[model samples]
Structures are given as C-alpha cells and as structure tokens.
Target chain A: MSTDSVTVHGYSTSGNCHKVRLVLEQVGRPYQWIEVDSPNGATRTAAYLAKNPNGKVPMLERADGAVLTESNAIICWLAEGTPMMPTDAWQRAQALSWLFFEQYSHEPYVAVARFVRGWTPIDSPRRADLPRLIERGEQALAVMERHLGRHKWFTGPGYGVADVALFAYTHCAADGGFDLGKFPAVEGWLARVGRTPHFVPMPLPHDDVRTLLAQH
Target chain B: MSTDSVTVHGYSTSGNCHKVRLVLEQVGRPYQWIEVDSPNGATRTAAYLAKNPNGKVPMLERADGAVLTESNAIICWLAEGTPMMPTDAWQRAQALSWLFFEQYSHEPYVAVARFVRGWTPIDSPRRADLPRLIERGEQALAVMERHLGRHKWFTGPGYGVADVALFAYTHCAADGGFDLGKFPAVEGWLARVGRTPHFVPMPLPHDDVRTLLAQH
Candidate 1:
C-alpha cells in the first residue's frame, strides 16, 4: 500500500489515536495525519461525526473513500499479513483478546483518567472521579503485571500490535495517578516495548493541557 | 472441530458471555457451558483467574488447554470463514469497529446499568449512577440508530458478529432504563437479527435478580 493513499484523522495526544500511529510507524508505512482535536469538541462536529458516528478517533480513510474507525481495528488492518499480526488463528485470537482488553479493561480507566487530569481544569468537578479511576486503573495494571510475569509479549511469542495497543495508555498511566512502581513486570514490559525497532513515543500533550497536567 | 472439544466458562447474565453462546448456537457448534456467577465472586476465584488472568467470564477453552477471553475475539474465532465474519478486509475492519464501539461506548453504559438495576437493591448507592448511565447509553443508541437507518446490518450487506456483539447488550438495553421507543431503526434492526437462522436469545436473569429488576 502506498503511504500517500491513506489518511489518518486523529488527535496526537490520545492514546487511542497514538496506538494507530505507533503501528504504522513500526511497520514503516507512511500516511498523512490530520489532527482532530477531540477533547475540544472537534470530534463532535457534524462533519466529523459524519465520518464516524461514534465521534471518536483515530479514523482511517483510504484513497477509495473507504473509512475504518476504532484504534485497534485500524492498527490491525495496517499490520495485517505482517509480523505485527499473528498468522496462527489461535495466537491471533489471543492477540485480539489483549487488544480488546486494552480498549475495554485498560483504556477506559487509564486513558480517561489521563484525559480528566490533563484536559480539565484542576478544580473541574470531573476531577472528583479521580480516586475511583486510579483504583480501577491499578487493577488493570495488576492484570498486565501478572501476564508479563509469564510472557514476553501480549501477542504470542513476539512484540506486535497487542503490545502497541497496551503500551499506548500504560506507559502514560502515571499521569493518571497510577503507581507503576508497584508493578515491576509491567514496567519492564513497557521498557521492552519502547526499545522495539522504529518505536515512536506519543507526543506530549499540547501546551495548555501540559500546564493542567502539571497542576493536577 | 468437534463440539465436545470446546468448553465455555461464562456468566449467563453477562452480555459479553452471552454473545459467545449466541454465536456458538447460531453456528450449530455445541459446547459445554460452565456457569460462572461473575457478580457473586465466581470470576475472582483463584481457579478461574488461573484460566483467565483477566478474571472475566466468557472464556473459551480447548481440549489442548488453550484459552481465549474477550467476548468479541471468542465470537470472531467461532465465526471465522462463516457468513458472520466479513471476507473483505474493509468490511471486516468495519465490523471490528462496531465490536470495539460495543465494548467501549455501548456496553460500559448499557450493560453496567442493566447489571446495577437487575442485581442491586433499589436503594443502593449505585442507583445514583442510573441517570448518567441512561444519558450516555442513549448516546450510544443514537449512533446505532443512525447507522441502522442507512444499513440493515452493522456488517456490510449482512448480519454478522458485529450485529451479535451489539445485539447482546442492545436487545436488553431497556433493562438499563433506556426507552427504545426513540430508536425505531435500532428496534427494527434488533428484530431482524432475531429472525436470523439459528438465533438464540440470552437466558433470563436469575429469579432473585428478576425480583430486583421488577422492583427497580
């Protein structure tokens, strides 16, 4: 696939969006990135919602006008038939299980907390939910810690999209008030993911959000 | 694959688990069902957690000891090469997007509200969340309503796992205090899914939970 034929609409700071970028980068697939400022009402715009009724990012648009949404789904499509996706059906299912885990179990708590802390004002009423978010996020981290104790990668036998899916939110979980120090195995796994070839870090939150993150 | 070689550990009331059973039934694959009462601490047991580190129900186990969790992944595996899964890569990605949306956007609100309303006492503090859950669940329903208005099914030109994934929670969304009267298109889609070959409805919640649900 030609890099210029694919366009990704995403907010750079979002772990969900960053997961797609990470996979594309790791695979050396070039694509255009259109910044969709989700936190500031961009995604909810009628124009954006027309593209994705769910009003979220990142969204992939092909040259033929075909569109695919959901971060994990997009990354899976980008990495199809590559080393990033397991060829074995059972292992692929196992990898997809972790992808679902990242979205359902891990991201909701960890990523939402990060969004709340960084994007909202320090005294925003939403901040009140931080304690519960942190607790739940820790539980998710614990699950990863246990898995990492016995396995080197979330995808069977190698680094792949599952690791990328997980690493997106997990590496930034501390910003959500999670104590990564308590989960050494997860910390090591995060390091391993970061050291993978062609790895690119999620960009820093924009300046205004960075200021709020620091205050929170 | 012989049905005798498959075992599914699940909570009958959970939409996630029920999606797996619905697919197995639709596909005419008979499998052993081990009822794990998740809300009653069944999934948290050390034995159950050993089989699924995430400690969630709807786990698929093979005779060879391989296990897969995450309802969408399990259903996709069960539906592989069948009409339930799209053969075209774009349609498959689109189906997966709905699966992700079902878990992230839809289930968290719709399914959780149903669990709270059906399992908790009317006066329980969790009931306080019902208003918010209803609001968000409606948003998810609206998205589905918009899509169903244009497409008869979530997957391209046919009913598939995406339909099953959304149907598991959506068909029972009224239990979560959502008034389906507003979403005519979605209501029609649900009925269409019910008429699919070999369809099976989710089992009713248990007697005590029924009492709680009635009172709520």
Candidate 2:
C-alpha cells in the first residue's frame, strides 16, 4: 500500500467489514487492513473506542486522523466520482434507498442469524430468535428478488455501492439458514456481483463455527 | 405550497415519516403532505406499492415523476448545498455514518418498541419482546448520550439531517417507556434540535392509542 493509503479497521469474518474491503478492491484503491475482532471484545478496548465510540468494525481512518464508520458511508465516499456511483442526483438517492434498506431490512435479520448460529453458544437464548429471523430474512430476500426481476443492479444501470452493500450479507444468506433457491433472481444477481472485477468473497467462518452453524 | 413543490406521502404519527416533514419545514421548502395512513394499511395498497415496492411511506415525488424514499436519503437530497448538509466530503461521510447508525443501531430498537406499545393490542404476543427491546434501546440511547456530551449535533457542525433523523424517535422515546430523564445530555440535545429554526414536533398518536401506550 502507498504511504498515504487509507486504513481500514475491520474483522475479516464480518460481512459489514468485508463490504469495505470489497469496495476498496473493486475501485482499485490502496488501503491497509487492521483486523479488529469485534465478536471477541477487541472493539471494546479503550484504544478502539477512542477511535470509534460506536465500537463497530469497518471503520475507515484517513492519514490526518479523520475517521468514518458505517460500511455503506465509507463505500460511498470511496466510490464517489467513479462509475461505481451514479452521477444523477435522483439515481443516487435511489441507490441510497437500497443501502438504507439493506441495513434496516436485510442485515439485521440475515447477518444476526448467522452470528447467533455460529458465534454464540448452542444454548444461548438468541438461538430462539432464529425462526423469526429466518422469516423476516426471507421477506427481505423476496423484496430483492422482486427488484432484480426488472433491474440487473440496485444502483440504476450498473453495479455500485448499493449492490456491494446488499451482496455482502446476501451472498452468505445460506449460512443464516436462508435458501437462495427460493429467489432465482437474487441468485443470479449474486453471481453477477461475484463476477465483478477485483471482487473478493468474504472470508469463510472458522471450521468449528461452521460445524456449529450446520448443526444448528 | 407552490405549483412546483414536491409532494410527500407520509403518515403523520410515524417518526420516520415525520423526519421528512421536519426537514422540509426547517429548510423553508414548499411541499404538499398527503397523509397516507400506514398503520391502517394505506401504504400496502397496490397503487402505493407501484410507487415504492418497499411499501413504506414518507416517499417524495418530484413534479416530473421522479420519486425518492428513505427519510435520511430524502432529506440529504433536499438539504444538498444547504446548511443542513456538510459541504466537506469527510464531514458528509460522518453525517451519513450517523444516518446509517440511526437506521441500523437505533431505530430497530427505539422506534419498534414505540410501535409495539401504541399500535399492538394489549395482550399481543409481540409484547414479550419489549424487555429486550428496551434494553437494546437504552444502549443506543447511551451511545447518543456520549456523543452529545461532546458534540452539539450529529451532523458535523450544525443541525442537519442526522440530527433530524435521530430526533424523530428520540424525542418520543418516552412513548416507548424509555425515560429520557436518564440521559441528561440526550435530553439537552433533543431541546437543541427543537430550537432549530422552523422545527416541528411529531404529531401525537390517536387518543385510544395514547391511552394504550400510557397504560404500558
């Protein structure tokens, strides 16, 4: 990485964090990655909290000490003035709508389910929420399926930050117990996203965690 | 409203919808409000779904037929080049981080608890989720409190969309059984938001719903 390259603090296994890495790669931006193991309490340290009071992973820090969190916001900043972001104001707003929808509608259900299954102990009370999470996650996937039926990308006319944002959790939905077979259009879109130039898949969960998720 | 003004479709009592109205009023923009009774199913109609497949209200329609949904996204577009938005790219990213945090970390807990208290029947099974929701909502509030202890506004320098986005549910957190009195800084921040020029309070819930929420 160049001396002035942006620095990203993230956890490799987190879809939220991975989205930033995906964008940086796709846009050919040089950046340094510092792994912050959020699930294991690394983000709670005073040093980490000093940088991000919110204590979430996927924080981007500039050389001048300016910091930006929220995976989609960082991606938007990185993709600005590139084809990865739309030029028209209205289309940009539409792209943002999808980004918001992904966080509010999709990630809460899907990503949380994956975390509950893989990261938490088998007897944890959060596992009880699985059924509801799966049901709600299906609804979110159906919305994406309906959108993809008519449009190839969430951002008007091409793949962009919205697509990257949604794809991060969605391509891994099966790990959350969501069946992609139910939404052919979404499946096709996921393939399209994977085929993007410089695209990198989210790192796989550890073997023991994968075993736990499978058993669950 | 002027002939060229945008039209906003929203439910009066919804914090998400009210955020849009608050921004438009604060910015002195002329816009028509079409009350869509989202709680009573207006937003779920085929006609409404045609405009927004997500079937949520607070959708803005331009005179030329373009539409934008997502309250924060709408406000950003409306506040573009205005004091309500940060002109610096990094500050803009900071504002968006708060917006995403509102939707992801804050709204799901605070807003949903309020909805459950007011909109659901007294004995609804969903009421069982309130304790967990309150616990999580309080955590979200604490983050805001900490931020308020240092910064005057969520948007970098002044009252902006992030402030508007957070204020909507936060001001009414009491309706969800959250005692804002616990967080002096958050309470003060709420007052600061209210004092912004042309600020408008969210509409009160209907009498029966208010009584229901009060009992809870």
Candidate 3:
C-alpha cells in the first residue's frame, strides 16, 4: 500500500462526493475512487457504517489507514499549504464561514430539492417538500447574490474551496426547480467558477433520473 | 472605536450563540455580548440584515466593523492559535470534520427540536417536526456515542473547538426530547466538557419558554 495515494469512497453523481474529486483533480493529487451506490443503500451497510458512523459518502482513507470524512473537510485537508485555502487567519475564517453556510443553509435546501426531484420516484411523497425547498433555496441564492455583488469569490481573492463546495450544488440547482436567471450576480459568479483552471463538472445522472429532472 | 476586542450579537438561550461565548471565555479573550431576540423578528430587520443578509443571530463583529457569521466559524476563528484549536494539520482536519458534522448532521435536528418544543406555541405546527427531529438527533448522538466510547474527546486527543461545538446542543438535547441516558458514553463526555477549565453554562431561556420546555 503506497502512502502517497489516497482512496475516496463516493457516489459519482453526488455533488458532495464530486467536490472531492474536483479538488483532487485541480490540485493533481493521486487517489483512487470507489463508487458507492449511495441512493441504493451501499452507504448503509454495516461495513460502511463501521468505517463512517454517520454512513455518508465521500470518505477519504489514506494508505496508512487514517480516515477523514466530510467533503469540505477532506478538500480543505487536501488543500492545506495550497493557495486553494487562504493563508491569512481572517480570510481563512471567512472561507470556513462560507463552507459552513453552504452545508447548513444552502445544501439542505438546494441539494435536497435536487435529490428529491431527480432521485426519488416521480410521485414520491417527498415531492411535497419541493415548494418549501425551492423557497428556502432561493433565499440562500439571494444571500450569495448579495455577497457576489461586492466580492468576486467566497474564498479570499480567489476561486477556492468555498466556491468548489457551493458550486457542487448551486450549479445544478435548476434541477431542483430554481430559476438562476433571477440572480444575475450569482449567475455571473457561477460562470466564472466554471472557467477556473482544471475545473471539472459533476457527472450526469442516469437516464431515468435525467428524465425526471427534465419533466418538472 | 477600539479594535482590541470583538463583540458577539446573539440570543442568550441559543446554543449556537453560547458556543461562541464558551470558546471566548475558555480562551480568556476579552469580548462584548449583545443580546438579540432571534425567535422574534429581530434578525430580519433591515439593520440586522445589513450586517448579515442571512438574517441569523450569533454574529461576531470586530471593533473595526468587520463582521463574521456562522456559530462554528466564529468559535473556530476565536480558538485559532490557542490550545482550543489543534496546530497539527491532520489533527486540525479531524477536528474540523467533527465541526462540520456538528452543524450538518447534528444541529439541524437536535437544536431545531429544542427550538420547536421550547420556544414555539404549544399548538404550533412546528411541533409536528419534533418526532422526526428527535429520531435524526438520536442518530447523531449514537454516532457521538460510538466515538466517545473509544476517544476521550472529539477534537483530536484533547478538548477543543469540536468539543465546544458539539457540546452546545448535545448538553441540552433533552429539551429536544432526546434520551441521553441511552448514550452513557456521550453523557460522560458532556460531563468532562463541563469540568474543563473556565467552563461556563449556557444562559437559561425566558420563563415562558422554560415552562413550555418542561410541560411536554
């Protein structure tokens, strides 16, 4: 086992998992990817649960057997000593703040809406949550619009981890029924993030999920 | 205005706000506290929204007028360069992993349960969310229990910001209808956190809220 490479257990279509791959590709880190069927209960198995008590994906395991969980935390650790994370204390704090905001305020609404829409059965009772999710998701987008209006990036002076974390879900928020055109500044920022060097997009979902996403 | 100290604007009974204060006190830092009525409409006012467009309490403002939002972010920043925050890169990453888990997996369910039960009207529709919140909150506590059964603390071999972050909501989880007695390991860890140096408890809620908490 080479300690120089890490292994990531993740579901490819998941934005949270995809962010780790994006960061690894951006920074040219050596790693192996093991696709977990997240929506199909791969993450819920006893073996997986033993490794991550929370039973979530995008888990990173070093060759030396040390494991790290949480996509943002994994990327941040991979970005350490790299320009992807700010060197200044206060700037680092702001970046971290955006990260927390992305997970708490943004993902719970935006990403979950996308999941319920694209992944669940078309008539799943979860569809009832769509209206509230979209409402709350738009509020998060407005907050991003306000910030992007004055500042170009969530990470200090650059397109960095916060951008990666937010982009994972925000880029595909339309699948969740969000109208991105309403926030011109956020739309502009999204394009800018896409244009960054070594940028990689999340893989498309299967045809069934894609069709569901397009239907509504 | 002197830039020597930071001021925290927060609701007194909120666990998120109290974590910031606990970190500051533990670090022996000079800071000012401003109370905000979060359950009311105070966080949504034009003045409050100007500083924080997200319209949340537990905002940290430096004397220079620079403001930071997000409870975990504020406490991590305050704990930086102190024993409260680990210096080693890998250890810091582990600590951060716990911080993210506390917010994403834990707080939304645990803290919101408490808010719904204790602060909302007896017949408020939000009370309907308590059962689901408590179920999810128990999963989080179980994860903590599994960890605490093996490790002394969440912050990488010591009591640190991760401890403070998890302690915020976990200590008062009963108000959310969680049975901490099921997690003996977690209960022991909470006691250890309370015994830490310069530890201070969260302020109690108003009489009406307290009465509401005890009724059901």
| Top TM-score model | 3
Question: Between the candidate structures 1 and 2, which one is better when assessed by DockQ?
Answer: 1
lDDT (0 to 1) per candidate: 0.89, 0.90, 0.93
On residues B56-163, what C-alpha lDDT tens digit does candidate 3 reach at each position? 979999988999999988988998888889999889999999999999999999999999999889999998888899899999999999998889999988899999
Between 1 and 3, whose DockQ is larger? 3
DockQ of each: 0.87, 0.78, 0.90
Q: Provide TM-scores for the models.
A: 0.97, 0.95, 0.98
The second chain of candidate 1 has a TM-score of 0.97
Instruction: State the lDDT of candidate 1 residue by residue for A1-216, as single tens digits.
Output: 335558999999899899988988888887899998788899999898888888888999988877899999998888887899998888888999999999888898999999899988888999999999988888889899989888999988999989999999999988887889999999999999989999999999888887877774
lDDT of 3 by residue, A1-216 (tens): 123789999999999999999989888889999999999999999999999989999999998888999999999999887779998889999999999999999999999999999999988999999999999999999999999989999998988999999999999999999999999998899899889888988999999899999996
TM-score of chain A of 3: 0.97
**Candidate numbers, best lDDT first, in rank order:** 3, 2, 1
Worst 10-residue stretch by lDDT in candidate 3 chain B?
B1-10
Give the runs in model 2 whose Cα sits over 4 Å from its true position. Answer: A1-3, B1-3
Model 3: residues >4 Å from true position, as ranges?
Answer: A1-3, B1-3
| TM-score, first chain, each model | 0.96, 0.97, 0.97
DockQ of model 1 vs. true complex: 0.87
Q: Could you give candidate 1's per-residue lDDT for residues B183-206 as a string of tens digits?
A: 999999999999999998888988
